[model samples]
Target: MDRTPANDTWFQGKAARSIHEDQLKKVELFNGRAAMIGFVIGVITEGLTGQGILHQIGLGPLVDGYATCSVQMLPFCF
Candidate 1:
């Protein structure tokens, strides 16, 4: 293959495509890591603030209902 300017131009397109693909992969990786880190921070903050899971999701009554059902089912389990 002759090292001509035309050949260089042809290779440039392929190089640009590979560079673009690498950049996109990097962006995706960064976004995924950022989301995971943010989630961990949020969970840690919530825990430090002393907010229980039921209270956090406004499902306090649901837990009470579950407790009641468990009590009712205790006899059946035996």
Candidate 2:
């Protein structure tokens, strides 16, 4: 532990670490807000179109086919 300026700069105090942690917190908050907004938009679109999220994304047939095969006990659905 020579306590040189370079070593001091590399080892930050609690305040400096807190600043970086605050930035990460803000980023996580914004990401969570965006996810909530997207989910609400998806629900509204589904309500207006009378279609599920999967159907709106054009995966309804693929999902339905898989369900049918699974129910019929098909050997290889993949």
Candidate 3:
């Protein structure tokens, strides 16, 4: 006896080419990786600038302030 699909609505003989296939995840995975790298760079630049401004204005803990700013971007990275 042979087992096969009863309908073609979903399968369409292309099940092997579906996005659900692990290999199809490469595009999305690459995009996510690129976005993560860009986000980290943006966070670092922005935080450093803020810290520089604060220090020039005689504020204390400028480095801590910058570090705190960078922390806020962590959740948004992913």
Candidate 4:
């Protein structure tokens, strides 16, 4: 294992060696916090609107439209 300048530079350039464990931990913590916040927001929205998260986002109609079209052989639904 020679510690020459070129070898050191090459090792540094490697993706596996570039990212530190501490950076990954930070990213994980940030993602966890974001998910928690999003879940709280969704719950609040559901409570206020009396609808689940998907319904609040207007996916309910889209999904129902597809189901109805499929079942009844309709051309389109919205």
Candidate 5:
């Protein structure tokens, strides 16, 4: 069997499509990971700085109380 220009063109098209699909998958994975990392960092930064949603919604005091209680309870359990 002899390879012709038409066959070569078709093969090239398929290869291009496969390459495009692989690249798209990589981009999607990268975007998802980046978004997750950004969200985690934002939450941590907000929690540490004490200016995030928790503080804005008045949950900060409740959380602080819970933390304090936990610390107080540790000595009794031992």
Candidate 6:
């Protein structure tokens, strides 16, 4: 039985596409992780800095804005 040349090319294209999709998924995962770390760092820094500034300004050091978020939604994970 002779293998069709077009079938070989199709399989090669499919394999390449699969690899591309995997790479895309990896990049997306990395970006998500980076964003999470950055958000945590930013929140901590902002809380500290704002508390200091508010204290200097004679206002209350702790405020109610710490629990706010940009993309507010129901708890996703915890």
TM-score of each: 0.53, 0.68, 0.38, 0.55, 0.61, 0.60
Winner on TM-score between 1 and 3 is 1
Best by lDDT: 2
| Model 6 Cα lDDT, one tens digit per residue, 21-69 | 9999999999999999977776776687755434444554233343352
lDDT of 2 by residue, 1-78 (tens): 598987787677766998999999999999999999988988999999988889888999987888778645676885
Task: Give candidate 1 misplaced runs (Cα > 4 Å).
Answer: 2-6, 50-78
**Ten-residue region with minimum lDDT total, candidate 6:** 61-70
lDDT values, one for every candidate = 0.80, 0.86, 0.64, 0.81, 0.81, 0.70
Candidate 6 CA-lDDT value: 0.70
Compute the lDDT of residue 14 as modeled in candidate 4: 82
Candidate 5 has its poorest 10 consecutive residues by lDDT at 69-78
Comparing 5 and 6 on TM-score, the stronger one: 5
Sort the predicted structures by TM-score, highest score first: 2, 5, 6, 4, 1, 3
C-alpha lDDT (0 to 100) for residue 3 of candidate 2: 89
Candidate 3, 1-78: lDDT as tens digits: 434565553465567567467675887899899999977776776587754444544764755655576565855543
Q: Which portions of model 2 show Cα errors greater than 4 Å?
A: 1-15, 70-75
TM-score of 2: 0.68
lDDT of 1 by residue, 1-78 (tens): 799999999899999999999999999999999999977876886789776556567886766666676665865542
Which residue segments of model 4 deviate by more than 4 Å?
1-19, 62-78
The per-prediction tally of clashing pairs is 0, 0, 0, 0, 0, 0
| Highest-TM-score candidate | 2
